[model samples]
Target chain A: MSVELIILIVVITALIFDFTNGFHDAANAMATCVATGAFKPKMAVLLAAIMNLIGAFLSTNVAKTISGGIVDDQLITPQTVFAALVGAILWNLLTWLFGLPSSSSHAIFGALIGAVLVQAGLIGIHFSTVASKILLPALVAPVVAGVASYLGTKIAYKGKHNLPKESKKRYRNAQRVSSLLVALSHGTSDGQKTMGIITLVLVAGTLQLGGDQMPWWGQAPGTGPHWWVILSAGIAIALGTYSGGWRIMRTMGKGMAEIEPPQGFAAETAGMSCILASSHLGFGLSTTHIVSGAIMGTGLARTPEEVRWNTAKRMLIAWGLTLPAAALVGGLAAWVAHFGSWGFLVVLAVLVIGSVTIKIVSSKNHVSHENVNDSHEVTVLAKAAISSVTETIPNPLAPALPEEIADHPLAASPLRLTGLKPRPKPKVPKKKKTPPKSKKKKQRKAAQQKAAVAKAQEHEAAREKAAKAKAAKEKAAATRAAKAAKAKEVNDA
Target chain B: MPSLIYAIDWMALLLVAAVSIAATVIIAALMSVSNYFFHPPKGEEKASQPRRILGFIFLGLMACVVAFGLYLMIPYFH
Candidate 1:
């Protein structure tokens, strides 16, 4: 392809990746509300779409980071970035198809870093910028979310005890307004990141601009994402939001916890607050982390039992790995592209094929809205498991639950669920006929049988223990009553 | 040097035209009422002042983006 043709193709490819990014992350904004039936899917997306467009008007902070902060544009043109974007886009599509909530932000970052590393060697890598901005936020956001949700749930349910009926109604109404504000805030903040990237591409194309030199940004703040750039980014994202990433919605909305309307509101509000604050300061905070954290926080607040630690562990692992992985990929792409056009083509093909393979592998379990609110899976360790299982005894005569069952949570199984943990994966020794899986399966079966026997044994033991405790408690009460009666008789006499 | 800026005038004009056309097309399509006779709503969802304020915010945003883009594209003070 001619240089002009190659550059044009690359630009289109970048926009395509941006579009995919839009769809990939839509659930970060609307999943909770949609999951809770705050709005119909269509309405939720429409609301998100319009607000995102409006949000594009708010700030240009994230855009600046994309266009200027990550890689030197002078060293690479729109074409090189285009190759990086292609890598990101492929990763996004594959992840979306399989319902993995892998970060698009990370994918783009990785692709850019990998390409840059390959091109300019280690010199191109801006480890500090990536760390301070992307890395810190990605790791911290979710932990913050988990803590916040834990606290928020604890407070809302506990605090409501003293309130009158009218006051509770008022709180519910307040949630509605707060939820909308969060949606608007998300649109403003995240929509800007894409804008900054597009602006970088445009500025890099011209001879007027030097390699990696940002004289304009030095002169002014919010000068990076040009006006048209904002419009395109907003429109693209809005359209993507309208299309929706349904698979991701299932993962974000239902996979994390049993999201009640109030909790959903709380999570979204927390996410919006974090996102808006970062956007204003020109920080390219990951909306994914913010939203994920918010959900985890709300989970903590309501019922720490329902927070799926196993699933969360995998997500955490992905979070930890995404930056270095993406950086490597981007660096590699940069290296290949440094050989000129042929290298770009080769990198692009590898990305497409590899992502497709990953998609095929990871899509064994597909999360959907139909099963989102169903009973907690064993794979997920939601605090709500106790409530769900205790309710499922089938016999009304089993036992009376304590008043604070949601608070004091107990697991029905002997396995002792501690909420979302990463499933222990066995490593392959590169030998033929691995028997570990079946061994693991047989082990699981034995464990299940043992659990059943243990349950029976524990049940009888528990009954005997409870019977004795009850007798003692009743006897003490009876003695107190008898003493009171005797004292009354003596006084009357 | 002067000719370089002048030569880019056409490219700049074309770029601006493409952008303006997109914006105008979007506005015209959304604001048009010609089809209302065929498919009238029981109640049209009206955008209130606050909503309009929000809409204007985007417009103001569009203006800022275009201004900044022009600033970048323009070659001055050689």
Candidate 2:
């Protein structure tokens, strides 16, 4: 195929990746809210989709990073980027197919790296930029998210406990605002990464700015892949969001946390803070990392047992491998593509054929809207079913068991939660090994324990921390009150 | 100086990095999964250290691979 046709094919493939990203990661923004019944599936995605569109206009820094920050677009060709994209897309598809929560950011980065190596060797790598922009955030962003969520959850609990029923209603009701902000923030942050890459392709191919001048369109393209590119990428991601990566959603929404509205709201708010900060700074921090870590952190804060360590570990592995894997495949593809236009055609044909086969096969094995919102227990069972179908689902302990996820029930192209094995169901009961004591005794003991702990800490710092903790307590108490009132009102009538 | 030795070593480093990156990810995933069956009753202390180490290894290997990959890809310009 000609270079023009080659670019077209590559962009389409990128869209395919984006589409997978949409359904695969939709849960990142909407899963908690969806799990909590804050919004119906349709309403949740619709809201997420619209905000994602609006978020496109947020900033162009991430776009710049992709197009210019990661690699020197000038040293390579549009074809090189195309090769990198294919590697990225393939990695995305493979991860999604396996249901591994791999990172698109990493995949793209990897593929770009790979393609650059094959096409032009390694003349234009920026170590400082890579470290400052990518590595630092990769490590810290998630941890920060987790910390913020843990704190957020503590506050949520105290608020639930102490706030008068009337005022606590305000925060619960304001979830709409926070949830939508997350979608908008997610869009603003994620949309720009694609823009940056495409623009990088344009600048590297068109302008001969000897590595010194980073030529950004700074404006939408009037003719080529311009504003339409921005609009399309946003819409693509939004549509992905709308499609709802429900499998990952279940893992995040229910598996990680028994999120009340307060915790969910706080997690979203904290996630928004991270995304907005990163977008403004123009770094390509993984939205997946920030949101999931925050949710897990909040869950951990709620109760240490609440955060599912197994699933979280699986995600960390995916994030770690995504960029390098993409880069590797990208490099391989570039090497393969070196065989003239025929090389590109063969690769393109393979991708088109392979993607179509997956779609057809996946359609047959879908989780469906009816079962999508089934309780977390049912979702785990659904995953268990997929694993049994594909004996490839390894004992998560086996070094390679990460790839056993045959179907991701939550997100689209974003695959994760791969380690599935025979549950030590018997052992699960062993953790609470105590024989069932009287319910009243357990409740009283729990309260007394909480009170005793509260009393022991009288220092001012502890007091302020307790003060923050008190808000979540009140919120939790209010929710309990609402549950009680609803029950009582039924009895009175 | 950006010596010839610097150039060739980076390429070799990339291959080592790739192998390590793949192994580290697979190893980390397995160990965590092993949590359920082998040591089904791990405390926070048990889980946290292995997890941190695994994560640290993954990041370390990835960074090394990227650094070296960039190193090799750099000399193709002139």
Candidate 3:
């Protein structure tokens, strides 16, 4: 394919990846708020969407970091970037489907590294930069956020406690404000990643076109993303946030732990702080990791029993596997796309087929706004296990009762309740119809109605004026009477 | 081990950790404190004037922190 065509494809794929990034991390901003009933699920996502859009425009430091900081852009091609995005996008979809909150940033980083390694080997990869800027920050950010959140949660509950009703009301309101801040910071940080990737593609494409210099908006060669690139990425992420990732939201909000309002407030505030700081420093750390860690920390602080260690273990496994898994897929994609036009077509076809298959399978157990907060399979399994153990202990008195053997309460009832009692239908009030009037008659009736309204206004104003006059006269008479009484009392004395 | 440690930007990493932890804690604490002060026990009357003023101060501090964060995002700062 022509270079121009390839650049176009890469840009579109980058936007697609940005969309997935927004929806995938929507849970990070909204999960706790939704779980704690601070905001309705739909409203929370809408607020997040608007905030993400505004946040995208706040700064481009992170974008510059991504485009130039991690990899040697001179050696990599736009096609390589495209392959990396495919890997990242597919992984994002896979994790979202499983209700796993893995890092989209890590997936993209892994894919880029793998693709670059396949194309130009170790020379194209910046190990030191990756180690310092990306990897180290990733390891530390979550712990920092977690510890901070733990302390915050501890302090929040330290005071002489208010009534449950009052405290809950206060915490819920506080959660609303804190969650908005998280969503705004998320927009500023996560939305910039796609902008960086798109800028990388543009830089590569410009170089291929024999342009030795970067665009004026960029600080230096490959230093900044173009304005249009920022706008497109911001819009894509905002749209994705608006769409809502109910499945992952359910996982983070309700699946990980039972989040109270105060804990939710603490977690979101801490997560927002870490993310905003990282973005300012241009570190592309995962907001998912930070927020999830904070949630877990707050859960531990509030009540250790509330945190689901098993679910957390599952999430950690997913996080551990994301890098290598995405790397392998990215390498394969790069190898396939190396063959030119036909290979590109094949890769595209595979991506479409794989995405369709995942969508079709996910439809079997769809998670949407209506059921985003419903207890998921893990909780259901636990409940079932508890009930089964309870059922096994046979009651000695009811050992021979066949009805008692039934699991359902209604089934065990001796009086058969066939169905719910039907209610009486409400009587509809009928409208009376009048005979059709001629045009002149209608006009006269309208005029008469206006006259009647004017007359009523006049009468009302007159009545109000009379009432005010009467009240003033009564007040004067009362004051005079009081003065006369005082004078008479003085004379009598 | 020294060489390996030297190869990494240990200073920057430490700075990041310290800054992140401090900022997160400050923000969370301010928010939680604001919540506590704003909502007193049910039997009691609503927040007194001074307590209300204190709550607003805490909330204002939190907003300042967020604003400062956004200010840091400007490319010129970096």
Docking class of 1: incorrect
Interface RMSD of each: 19.8, 17.5, 2.9
Q: What are the runs in model 3 whose C-alpha is more than 4 Å off?
A: A61-68, A159-163, A211-227, A281-284, A376-493, B1-4, B39-43, B73-78
Chain A TM-score, each candidate: 0.65, 0.68, 0.73
Q: Candidates 1 and 3: which is better by lDDT? A: 3
Model 3: residue A312 alpha-carbon error in angstroms? 1.2
Q: Per-residue lDDT for A457 in model 2?
A: 61
Of the two candidates 2 and 3, the one with more favorable DockQ, higher being better, is: 3
Ranking by lDDT: 3, 2, 1
Model 2: how far is A304 from its true place, Å?
1.4
Backbone clash count, each prediction separately:
42, 55, 0
**TM-score per candidate:** 0.58, 0.61, 0.75
Candidate 3 lDDT over residue span A231-272, tens digit each: 999999999998887878988898877878888988887787
Q: Which tens-of-lDDT digit does each residue in A1-493 have in candidate 1?
A: 5544554566556666667777777788778877777777777777877776776666555544463455564566665587578667766776576455778878887788777766677787656556655665576556554454444444444433233343234334434544555555655655666766665565554443445565432223344565666777778877877777776777778777877765664565455445543443344457787678778777766666877887677667767766666666666666776676687678667866876775565334433334334433322222333323323333333355566663332423322333544233356678676678889899899999999999999999999999999999999999999999999999999
Stretches > 4 Å off in candidate 1: A58-74, A159-173, A208-228, A281-284, A346-493, B1-78
- For model 3, the local distance difference test gives 0.77
RMSD (Cα, Å) of candidate 1? 23.2
Residue A301 Cα positional deviation in candidate 1, in Å, after optimal superposition = 2.1
True contacts kept of each: 0.00, 0.00, 0.55
